[model samples]
Structure formats: structure tokens, C-alpha cells
Target: MELQQMRYVVAVAETSNFTRAAEQCQVVQSALSHQIARLERELGAKLFERTSRRVRLTSAGEAFLPAARQALDAAERARAEVAAAAGEIRGRLAIGAIPTVVAVDLPAELKQFHLRHREVRISLRSGGSEELIERVQQGTLDVAFLGLPLGVRPKGVHGRELARGDLVAIVAPGHPLADREHVDLHQLSDEPFVDFPPRTAARAQTDEAFAAAGARREVAFEVTTVDFMARLIRQGLGVGMLPAAFVPDVPDLPVLRLRDAPARMEHLIWSRFPPSPAAAAFLSGLGISAA
Candidate 1:
């Protein structure tokens, strides 16, 4: 019923433990529990199923969670708008990015944003481009950086292309093609490769390239991180393809230009709805007019 009660409910649902939720909310367990009970009574539904060991959300809680979060977000945005009108930014900025983001220097940008708006809180998260886009659409993230195969664009969100480039092959020092200045997909297809998980956008770029070339590549290692993929290549476990921007991360490995390569498009995305003041300021700092 009350905003404070909704906040307590959200914290409890997220932590799944009353005591931990109380600690997170900076209140005593008894007070937090009492407030939640009062809210449940007003709603005529039990929000949680508490046991001696674990606390689980009841069906009613599951149904109410999304709206509660949206309400809280709305309240926060209203306060932030008022502050912004007074020439101050005061709200949380939630940003999401793919792990291999190279289009912008995130750390430097965040530093500048913090210096400009000391009252704003910033949070960053890493995930797949598709996943990041979903989070932005759901209002969980105010903005996101994404990378996808060329010719593909993000849906259900406002986005713009930042950069696009071809991928290059990486090989170990003593490998057969290590000395080659350039190679085609067919030439690298026969070699064992290390790549991101199957069906991921990063992996799809390589997969689609090889398929178009009528070549088959055996994936010897399925890795989630660029560092691990580089390590596997350095050890001669397999060859890999990555955007040219990422080559500096594995400078020791030999990089070969792919004559027929998949191109990756990097983009900046945000919710179609108007962004929070913090998000708008961050975008303005980047010279992007926030929609």
C-alpha cells in the first residue's frame, strides 16, 4: 500500500530471507516483518511462504513483484525529475554492456559522469548483447552497449550503431598459418577452434561465416571469456576469430586478417521510453541525444 512497504517487500523477495532483507533495508527484522505483514493483510493475500530454513515467494508475491518494481521506479524517476529541474541529477543509473565492449572507454566515461553529478549512483553489469537489450527493454537497465552480427538491429528498444568491423583469426606462434598475412574462412575452417557458447551472438558471427563459406569448424573449446579463449589459442589448443579491436588483449598471439570474415556491429541501446535523468546526462556526455 505504502511506498516504504513496497520497498520492504521487494528487498525481502530479492534476498528470500527476512533477516537479510532487514539488514539490506537498514531496519530491524521485527519491524520489516511487521510492515510486510501489514501490507499482506491490506492486500488480502499472503506474499511469502516462510519456513524454518528458507523463505519462498507465494503465488501472490510472484504476481505482485513486477508492478511493485515499476511503481518504485516511477517514484524514483519523479524525484529525479524534480531534482534535475533544480540543476541537479540525483538517481541511480543502471548500465549494461557486453563483456567485450570496445566502442567506448567505460571507465573513463563513468569517471567523468561521477565528477559532473556526484549525487547520482551508477551500476554496471555485463551480459550477452541480447540479454542486455532485454534488460534495457524491461527497465532493469537504463542503457546498454551491445554487439551483434552485421545487418542485425536491436528490436523493441532505441539504439544506434557505434562501430562496425571485420573479425580476424588468432593463432599460436608455431601454428601452420601463423605467418600468413591473410586467410579466408575456408582455410581456417579445418582447424580446431575455440569459441563462445553455441547459439550466442558472438559465436553466431563465426558460425554463419563458416557456413557461408561452405566450411566446417570443429569447436575444441567452448569458452565464455575472451581471456580464456586467448589462453587456449596461445597454448595451441585451437584457433579463434575476434573483432580487430580485441586483438590488443592477446597481443602475443598471431593475428591473421580473414579475407572472408564476419563483421560485427556495435551499438548503444536504451529503453524506447524516456530515460531517467541520470541516463540522459550520461548519454549527453557521450554526445548522444537521449530519446
Candidate 2:
């Protein structure tokens, strides 16, 4: 099968929409569909089930997608390697970061890296730490900033510690614990809380701390982003825990250190597999040795 057809399959798998996949691949929808149909015929298995409402991968497509993605990545890496040999650092670098990563000055770092390597393309995605880590392991993200539990390291991913800091409690000025310098997990047991949803590293850290303290908090609001959590806390919806950097600087919003909370360590993680040349260069620019 042609490499371009493999790319089309991967794109359709990712988008789950033929038109969007075609747009992403910079090809016409009919052509992309024709190519995919040819590929399915060649393999004697339908890759996708198409309907008016949605396009979803068939069972065979699910089985084939991972290898297809790996082949695409391998081809891109080969091109990047040749570019590196020619003294050119040119390729796409997909990076992931959690919402609470403001403390790392990521924008400034990326600006500098881009200035130094203008030919490199950078794509940034924001998600929960666990999601970012999963993407890294899946080879979708070249590198990611993850807020892992203290002393906890995920398997099959190489990570370097970027920063370690306490998770602080944020509340409105009139909240009972607002004036406190530090609040223990148990103290907020009965309080209404705003927090990250399950499967997020920040949520995991908070859950572990509360469980260790034998406290069960009432989650009044569950948000996907730190900024939204801050806004909710500021509106007195509920108190929430986040990295200090993620807490807004409003005068009426108070940030108190968590007395018994374990520090969350921000790690720059990547897959154990070899990195693309662009990824390697970006990591090196960040003073990380990806090798």
C-alpha cells in the first residue's frame, strides 16, 4: 500500500470524519475516500464504516491503525534524520502540557526555541497530565509536561523533573478558610469543592491526599481547566486546589498552602522510543538530554 494511503487512513481514524480528514490531508474528500476504499479492497477488510452522521473505524481499522501510525512516524523520522544530516532541523514537534504549567514559563521557552530553530514546526496541546502522558506513550505527542504525584513515575515513559511545588487551596475572600495560611485536607472535608475530573494527575493527587487524610470532599463542580476552576472558586462556588501559579491573582481570591498535601512534580516526559530529530533538538534547547 502507498504511504499516502496509510496517512489518509490515520487521518480518518483520528478525525472520525471523512471531510475533516481530507481537509487535514489537503486532499479532496472523494479522492481520500477512493484511496481508502482501494486500500480496504487490497487488504480485503473494510477499514471504516461510513454513515451520514459519523465515520468510525471498523474492527479491522482499529487493529491496523497503530501499525499505520508507526509507519507514518517512521517515515517522518527518516526524513528528519536526513534533514539533520544536512544541517537542517526541520520537522513537526507535537508537545503537550497541562493547564497548570504556567510556572514553567512555557511561552517564553517556546519562543526562544522557535527563534533558534525557525524551520521547526511546533504544535501545542493542552490536557490533563494523565492524558498528556498517554499521548506521549502513544507517540502522538513528542514531549509533554506532566504533573505527577510526588515520587511516582509512570512506566514506559522517560521523564525529567522540571519543577516540584505544593498544591494550594484557592477560595473567595469571604470563605471560612480564606484567611488561613494553610489548610489541612480534613478541614475541607464537608466543604463544597471545585476540582479537576477523574483520570487527571491533579485530580489523582488531590484524591490521594484526601484519602490519606480520611477526608471525603463534596465536589460541587468538576472542570477540565485550571482557569475555569479559578473562576468558579472566585465566584464562591467552592474552594479548589491547584498549583499556586494557576491560582488567579485577584485580590479577593486567596491562595492557602495545603498542610498535608504532597508536592506535585512537573515532569517533561517522552516515549521510550527514539525521538524525531525535531523533538531531540527541542529537548536539547530546553536543556534536556532526550538521548
Candidate 3:
């Protein structure tokens, strides 16, 4: 029933190893085990099934995990609120971003934010736009930089457009269409393409554009990172369509604007509920209106 016991249980469940969980909790393994055992006795149910090889959560533990997390989250939020009332900003801000969002200079912005609010902690995670948006809506992420297709908005979240640009085609110097200043979608329909996997914003935008143009492309390779895509293009594996900013600037690689391509939009997305003070300060620093 004690808060510390709840933390111990959650930690053990997350790590699935008593030794590692005790290490993370900064407690002796025996002490941590004793506290969890005491908690289990109080609850009249075992939380975890301990085996020599691995620790698995019991049904009771599985049922209690979400409530335990919520209790910890609420406690932290209360502490943050008290800190805010005292004119201090100190809390963890979990931010998510899509890979191509490098155009926004996030590291520099986060550095300035950190300098200004040294007590505040920032955690960044990278994922596809869909996954990032889901995390934000689920309250796991404070904010996310998402690459959204035009006119597509995630439900249960508020978004502010940060940047907008068109998707471009990138090719190696020796490629047949490398010299073209502008290429239409249909022109690359039959070309082998190195593309982002489905469910990513870039892939969705590319598919929509090609569908609109009545074109179908052959995807030879699927990659999640823009850097890998750039490498693939440089190796002449296949052509790629990505946000103009994501295409690397190489002497032999050429990026051409796609004719009639849909514009790619980057938005800072957050839950519709009020954000923590630290998250608000970050949004303010970035000149994004959290309202």
C-alpha cells in the first residue's frame, strides 16, 4: 500500500529481473524483495511469479499495473504543480518526433530550453507519425513533432503547424532522371523506389500522390530512417521520395521537386488536456501557441 512498494512492483515488472530492478531502484535486492513480499501479503495476492530464468507478472499484477502507473503519474503531477506554484519549473517532459523533423533544429531548441530551465528534464523518442500521435493522445508523450499529410488531423489532440514543404524525388547522378529539375509522379511510376515503410507519414504522402496521379511505383527497399534512404539512393539502389529537407546534400545526389506532389506538413501535437508547466515552457520557447 505504500508508494515506495508500488514503485518497487512497477520497477520489477518493467525490468523483469529483481537484481536489475533493485539496481534501478537503488536498493539492495533483499530489501526490495522483502518490501514487495510485504505488499503482496497486504494485498492477499501475489504480484509476480518468480522463476529462476525470468520473472513474469501474475494476473493480479497485470491488473494492478495500470493503476500503479496512474498513481505514480498523479503523484509526479502533484509535485510539478507545487513546484509551478512556487515559481519554479521542474519536471520531466517526454517529447516524440518523426525522423524527418530534423529540419526544425530540435536539438538546438532543447539545448536553449535546458539552459534556461536547468531543473527541467527532457526525454526524446523517435517514431513514425502515427505512433507518435498515438503516444501523445495516450498521455505518454507531452508533445510530438509529427509529419502529417495535408488535411489529416489526429483526433483527441491539438496540433500547431510548424513547417510545410513538398516531397521531392532523390536520385543518384547516373540515374536516368537525375538531371531533371522537376519530375512528375507518373514519370517515376515504373522506377524502383527506396521508400519509407507503410504507416509512416512520408510513405502515406507518397502513396497518396502516386494514387492521385494514377501511378504505381515498385518499392525495392523499405527503410525507416532518412539517412539510410539517402545511402540507398547514393548506392543507386532506387529512387526515393521524401520531404525536401530530409534529402541529404551530396555532390552526386540530386533532389528534384515532384510536380503536383502534395505538401508535407510538420506539426507540434499535444493532448487537448492542459500540459505540464515544463511542456508549456518548451512550447513557448519554440514560439508555438499551446492554446
Over all chains combined, what TM-score does candidate 2 have? 0.90
Per-residue CA lDDT of model 2 for 135-235, tens digit only, reads: 99888999998888898887789988888888888788788877789778888888899988887788888888888888888888999986787788878
Q: Best lDDT goes to which candidate?
A: 1
- Expressed as tens digits, the lDDT of each residue in 1-291 for candidate 1 is 899999999999999999999999999999999999999999999999999999988999999999999999999999999999999999999999887878998889999999999999999998788788889989999999988999999999999899999899999999999999998988887899999998788999989999989999899899888888898898999999889998887789999998898999999999899888999999999999986
Clashes of 1: 0
lDDT of 3 by residue, 1-291 (tens): 888999999999999999999999999999999999999999999999988899989999999898998888788888988999999999889999988785579889899989988988889998899999889988889999988889887778998887788888888877888778988988888889998888777788888888888888898999988788889989988988777776664445788887787688888888899999888889888877687
Total backbone collisions for each predicted model: 0, 0, 0
> Which candidate wins on TM-score?
1
Per-candidate alpha-carbon RMSD to the true structure: 1.5, 2.2, 1.8
> What local distance difference test score does each model get?
0.92, 0.86, 0.87
lDDT at 118, model 1: 94
Which parts of model 2 have CA positions greater than 4 angstroms off? 248-252
Clashing pairs in 1: none
- Ranking of predictions according to lDDT: 1, 3, 2
List pairs with backbone clashes in candidate 3: none
